[model samples]
Target: MSLRDRLTEDLKLAMKARDQLRMDVIRMIKAAVLNKEVEVKKDLDDAEMSRIMTTMIKQRKESVEQYEKGNRVELAAKERQEISIIEAYLPRALSQDQLAEIVDSVVRETQAASLKEMGTVMKAVMAKLAGAPVDGKLVSDLVRARLQ
Candidate 1:
């Protein structure tokens, strides 16, 4: 089944099960997608939806960090719970070793010999990743190290 369909099913299950936290996270996802749809005046494809999820996860992580710094343990814990719920729909993250291998391959494929060609390398690597939920920071670090 498509991710959207699965999300809808899960949302219904969460409602029936009285899983308030899970339901809230799913609703947040739907709202984000709806906002994006309104912004673009069209529905999002799976890749776009996946990108939205990734962005939301990143935002939550940053929030968790800031909350912790401010000594707000309860808020940080809540954000962590929300992250776990959101992650259920995302693709499995790539291992660092796997990402490094991918970066190496892309560097070779694009003939990117040095940091001077970082843009070409990044574009190629991101395209190679497509919709998979790999970390951009990790990929860029690997590519930079490999090229150097």
Candidate 2:
């Protein structure tokens, strides 16, 4: 089944299981997906749905960090829970070594010899690694290190 279908099924399961946290996360995801469809006047493909999930995960991570820094452990934990739910829909994240290898390949492919060419390399790497979870900051650091 498609990601959207799976999410819908999961939402139903969450409701049946009385899983409030999971239900909330799934509802939010469905709402986001619907909003995108309305905004673009098109149904989202799997890749687009995955991108939405990835964005949701990223937002939750940032919220968790902010909550933690503000000494709001409860809120941080809630955000972490939401992240866990959202991440269930995303592909597994790349390991540091895997990320480094991909970045190296992109850098070489783009002939990015210096930091000035970082954008070029990043674009190539992101395109190549689309639909896979990768840490942007880590990729930037790797590209910078290679260029230097």
RMSD of each: 0.9, 1.2
* Candidate 1 TM-score versus the reference: 0.96
lDDT of 1 at 132: 88
Report backbone clashes per prediction: 0, 0
Clashing pairs in 2: none
Per-residue lDDT of model 2, residues 1-148, tens digit only = 9888899899899899999999988989999999999999999888888888888888888998899899999999999988887888887888989889988888777777888898889888889888777777888888889899
Off by over 4 Å in 1: none
lDDT of 1 at 97: 88
lDDT of 2 at 97: 93
